[model samples]
Target: MPVNYTEDAFNGLIIDTNTIPTDSVEFGASLTNILAYSAENNKGITWLTLPIEKSHHVGRATALGFIYHCCQAHELTLVHKNQPAQFVPFIPSHTVGAGALIKNSAGEILVVQEYGMTGYKLPGGHVEQGERIEDAVLREVLEETGIKCEFVSVLGFSNKHPYKFGKSNLYFICELRPLHNHIQILDTQEILDARWISLADFQRDAKNSAYNHELFSALFNLSGLQPQALENNKGAHKKLEIFFANHKDGLL
Candidate 1:
C-alpha cells in the first residue's frame, strides 16, 4: 500500500509512520517515493513522526535531510522542508508553569521549600502535556506538598526569557482553597520541607520571597482572571481553558 499521509493547510504533508515498513530497505523506498511526490507537487514541508521502536530509522531519515523538531513521550517528530523559504514550522518557544497559592481555614498559606530554594515558595511545577492549567496546579500542589486543594482563580503570571533551553517561561500564580489541611512531603528529593504558615507570618518573614508575598496580596486585593467555559466546534483540538476578567458585573 502507498504510504498513508495527510496534507496540511500549508500544502505540507504529514506522513503516518505507522504505515512505514519496519524493514530498512522498504523504509528507504517508501521515503523516496514520498519525497518525490512532495517535490513534484511543490509541497512546502513534510512532517514525519517516528515511534520509539523505529529509532534505527532516524539516521536514515536524517541522512535524507530531515531535521529534529521536537519529542514527546516515546515518539520523535522530524521535519523536512520541501520549499524551505515558503513555509516556516512553528517551534515551541515557551514553558508554562503553575503555582498554587493555597490558603486554609486557619488563615494559613501552604508553602514548600525545594532543595536549592533559599526561601519558601508556593507548591507548584510545570504543566504536563495535554494537562489543563487548573489541573496542573492542583497536581503540583499534591505532588510537592501532599495538599488537596480547590483551584480558585489565577492571581497573576510572570513572563521571562532566556529560560531553560533558551525558551521563554510563563509562571501563573493560582489561588486555591485547601480542602485537606494536613501537610506531608511525598517526594523528599525535590522538596526539602512542606508546612503551613500564618498569612501574617508569611508576609513578615524575611525568608519568604517578595514575589510570593505579592501574589498573596493580589488574592485579597485584586480580581484575578477566572476560567471561563469555552466551546469548540472544531473537534480536532483539545479542550481549552480561557481566563477572563472575573468581574461579577459584565464588562461593557
Candidate 2:
C-alpha cells in the first residue's frame, strides 16, 4: 500500500515553494541525490516524483501519505517537485511523550514555569525508553511539581515541530488528580515556579503571554475539549469529567 501522490489530490492547496529562498539550492539537489542513493541501495525499489502546485494546502498530509505508502510497499523514495523538488526520507517509527492537564480543587488549571523558558506551561516530558506514556507523565508531574497524580483519561494526540533530535508524531494528553497538599512549592531546576491559574486568568493572560497562548492553543486543540470555566475550586475534579465527556469520542 505505497501511497502515491496524484496531481488531482493536490488540486487547490497552497504550497509556496518560492518562499524557501536558499542561495545554495541545496534542498532540491540534496533531495535528488537522496532518491538516487536510496534507489541504488534498495534493490527492486523505484522512486516516484510528482509535481505539487504552489497553492496546495495539504502538503504535510500528502508528504506523510507518500512516505507511508512508499515504506509500506518497500519502495525507496517518493519525491515532490514544487518550484524545486524535495525528497523526503522514509523512516517508520513511534516515540512516546506525556502531557498533563492538571487542575486544582478550585477548578483552576495547574501550570509550571520552566527555568529558562518564558511563560507557564503544563507539566510534561518525554517518556523514557522503557516507560509508559501515562507513567512517564505521572513521574514527570511528581518530579516537577511534587504532587502524585492519578491518571484519569487521555485527551488526544499531537504532532510537534520537527527538529534535529527527531520528530514526534504523537503526544498523549492526560487528565490527572493530585494526591498531595499544595504546600510551599519546591522549585526543581527543571522548573522555576508553579501555580494554579483560573481558566479566566489563563484566557486574560493568553493574548499577552506567548508561552501561555502557545501552550493553551496546543492543549485546547490537541484534545478538542471545550474550554469551560470551573464553578468553584471545590469542583476541580469535575473539570476532567467535563473534558472527557466532550472529547472521549476521539481519544487515543
Candidate 3:
C-alpha cells in the first residue's frame, strides 16, 4: 500500500513516517508504491523522514534512490526528486558566531584565552538555535568572563569556509560597552584566563590575527552597523533584528 503523505507548498510530497510499516519488507513495498504514485501524479519531490526507531527502513529508502538531506537529534530527512525540472531547497549551510570587543575607560580591551588555544582572543561562541545575535554575544561574553556589558554596534564579520563539521562559519565582530570593570573567570573549563589588555599591548602582540589589528587600527573611523527598531512590528518581522549603517557615531 502507498504510504500516507501530504503535498507541501512546492508540490513536493512529505511522507508520514508514522504511517509507514515497522517491518523493512513492508516499508520497501509501501515506499515503492508511493514513488510510483508520486511520479504518476507529477509530484515535484519526496521527503522521507525516519525517526530513530525506524532506522532499519533507512536502507530500504536509500535503495529506492533517496539521498541524505539533513538530520536532527532523533530523526533523519531524505529527499528524492520526482520532477526533473523542480529544484530541491537548500539546507542551512552556515553557523553563526559572535565576538565581543569590549573596551573600558582605561583603554584596555577584555580578552580571554580559551583552553587548548594559545594567546588571548575575544570571548565568544556559536549562536544557539532561535537565538538573537546580540543576545548570543552578550551570553558568551558573560559566560566566559564575568562582566556585564551593553550592545554597541556590529563592527564587522568574517566568513570561513569548510569550518567545523564542513559548514561555513560567520563570525560577527561586536562592539560592546562594559557595565562594570571587575573581571572574574566564569567558564573555568573552556576559558583559561580572562583579563584586560591595553590597546597598545594588544596591537603589539604577534599572537593577534591581522584581521584583529586592522579592526583596531581602523576603529577610530569606523562607525559599524547598529540594529534599528522596525516600524512594522507584527507578524513574521516581529522578532527580526535589522542592522543599519551607523552614520552619526564612530567607534573611537
Per-model CA lDDT versus the true structure: 0.80, 0.54, 0.83
Clashing pairs in 3: none
Writing each residue's lDDT as its tens digit, candidate 3 over 70-155 gives 88889898998875555564456888899988889988889998776667788888787678899999999999999999998888
- Highest lDDT: which candidate? 3
**Residue pairs with backbone overlap in model 1:** none
**Model 3's TM-score against the true structure:** 0.61
- Candidate achieving the largest TM-score: 3
| Count of backbone collisions within predicted model 1 | 0
| Ranking of all candidate structures by their TM-score, best first | 3, 1, 2
Q: What is the TM-score of each candidate against the true structure?
A: 0.60, 0.47, 0.61
RMSD values, in order shown? 14.2, 15.1, 13.8
For candidate 2, the C-alpha RMSD (Å) to the true structure equals: 15.1
- Candidate 1, residues 1-252, lDDT tens digits: the string is 666888864578999877977887778778888988999998878889899998888988998888898887788888888756743434477888898877677777788998877789888988866679999999889888887888778888899898853579888988888888888888676799998888788889887789778767667545568887666624667456878775468551
Worst 10 residues of 2 by lDDT: 1-10
